[model samples]
Target: MNTYQTLLVSTLFSSALLFSATSHAIELPQLQQRWAEIKYQQTGKQQESAYQALLTEASAARAEHANDANYLIWEGIIRSTYAGAVGGLSALSEVKAARKLFEQAIELDANALDGSAYTSLGSLYYQVPGWPVGFGSDKKAREYLLKGLAVNPNGIDANYFYGDFLLQQKDYQAAIAAFEKALAAPDRPGREQADLGRRQEIMQALSLAQQKAK
Candidate 1:
């Protein structure tokens, strides 16, 4: 794989910090629950295969709940993660599909799943290649991530990703602040494993940002 694909694939499977939501409000709670398990519980080839299966399941869920922002966002999340898992030229198509799904979710409801669409899109914009290659754009990433924060300023995923973007931009202090906020975000009631994993990621980001600041 090329540089963009390599980085994109490795970083794609970062699960979202999901919170308990009203049953009717969430179109696919089962998918969300299964997703957290597959992302944080599974490992290596097993994890990758699970993600691949989950992507298919997510696609079916989307077909059933067409136009539902929740389903759209979840499916997009799965697509992105699966792309990261597979990591090849073929994965490129999956990410592209994921990007469109996120955009569609935003158009339907920017606040669905705690503004996850914006956050996912921001992550994708930064991960994908820019022009002449893919559609990655640091500028767009910052804009979308900030929009995600505007919708859910204290959201764990939003802050963590924003911090990641800042770190990439060499703003170590700002990245630290963002990671600190992410660490302070609330835990998911039914998603303890995902919370644990995300906390580990936040802590690692914190350590790196602190080191870079010194």
Candidate 2:
């Protein structure tokens, strides 16, 4: 090979090695932050390239910290987001992968972050469509969600998702109660506007559910 070609190959190899080393050194929190940033970008616009880059980084972080429950959960969440962006079969595969990751997290630490993994899995199971081979387990969904709520009665995600599930089941009163609990949760991590906006949306949904129940 020419000198230039030889130099290029060597540089590529060095870059790969450096990336491998750096990925191993990355922490779970950093990965989670990146995932969150990517999610924010996704909300603003359909920036596939940015999302892909974040997912690539997240995958590397996940590989380096395979035993961490938080990493596993974020990895699953990122995959699910990617799948949602690319719908159809790809989305289904992503959701399935996410479900497995959440399950793994639960297995490792069922009580982590007040049973966030259980709440996630519950919502996924409930929201995912019933199918011949993938997802759609209402029974499993309810079981996990209740488990989450049992662990932390005021868990935002658990209450919100369970409320949605109740609405689907036509248990309007139960749904309203759950929604109210979610809205009333104190000191949640988000800003006031975000939190209040979410509460407002839930209240609207609850109102609709109440009317339907009547």
Candidate 3:
């Protein structure tokens, strides 16, 4: 992949794993857990294949719970992850589709999974290519990230992604603060595995940001 494409994949994967909520709704939580296992435990083609099959289950869940915000969000999340793993211009469609689902999930209930729609949409806005290539803007990313933070001020995903945005902007100190907040976030009962993985990322990013700060 080219420079931009590689960055896109990396950003999407990082952001994809950011929205692990407290787990709700029987099947939605199941999807969430399954995604975490596939994302954190599996890799390469195995991961891609797992996300592919999960999409089928995600589709069924979304169809079954059309009005459920969590379902829409999870489906969107899975789609985004799959696209990230696939990596390339061709996956842009999946990204767009995921954005739509998140929008719908927000319209139904932004607070469904701790304002995950805002975080998800915000991450996508800033990470994707801009204008003729894709839709990306730092301004929009900050807007949605702040909204997500407002909804869930102490959420792990919210702080972590905001830290990432700050890191990208070269706001090292603020990024450090946000990453620290993410680390201090309360433990998510059913999502311990994902939390472990994410906290590792947090520490790594935090270390880098910290080094850059000095």
Candidate 4:
């Protein structure tokens, strides 16, 4: 082919590549918006419906970007949330599936989505029952949460979950500090609803921490 024709073809290919990347990146905000809305649902039945919808979308996104760590992390997050909404002994299996997704995401890119896998995995470790029943471990929870904090010190999830772990450990003073840090976290753009919800949770935790500290 002539030089001009070759250059035209190269430019078109580059544009196509850019378009593909942009399309994939756009899914993140879409997922976040859906998640925020799902979390806002009041009744358990409503939450269950919302979670199912979000999970369907998340699963599709994950399939589209099978190798994308961000998509994998989000899938895990959505799965974990859905499991919580399901609420019962059976939900443990769903959480375990979520853990596998999170672990796979970490393996692909530990820092993707601001080290979200670490934050979530840490939460699972503490939220699940310990001993003969489940794999929960306070020590592992703290360690993973600290790792997430190392990467995203100002992240709302990192601080809030860490504070929760501390609260569970009865270190009320430290819990207060972490909760305060979470409250001070900058609002995540395009995630206003999520931020609002998270801040409310932080305030509740802070209130309890304060009472315990006193």
Question: Global lDDT of each model?
Answer: 0.87, 0.78, 0.90, 0.89
1 against 2, candidate with superior TM-score: 1
* Predicted structure 1, TM vs. truth: 0.84
Itemize residue pairs with steric clashes in candidate 1.
129-136
The residue-level lDDT of candidate 1 at 88 comes to: 68
lDDT per residue, candidate 4, 58-78, as tens digits? 888898899999999998898
Q: Report the CA-based lDDT of candidate 1 relative to the real structure.
A: 0.87
Distance (Å) between predicted and true CA of 120, model 1?
0.7
lDDT of each residue in 1-214, candidate 2, tens digit only: 9999999999999999998777564566665555555554355345556667767777777787878887778777777767666667657877888999999999898887688788888888887788785678999989999998998898666788899999988889899899989978875553444455557668888888879878
Worst 10 residues of 4 by lDDT: 20-29
> TM-score ranking from best to worst?
3, 4, 1, 2
Tell me the tens digit of each residue's lDDT in model 3 across 1-214. 8999999999988776774432222487788899999988999999999999999889888987899998998888899889889888977898899999999999999898899999988988877777887777899999999999999999999999999999999999999999999999999989998899889989999999999999
TM-score of 4: 0.86
lDDT of 1 by residue, 72-180 (tens): 9989998898887777677889889999999999999999988999999999999887887788899999999999999999989999999999999999999999999
Residue-level error in angstroms, candidate 1, position 95:
0.8
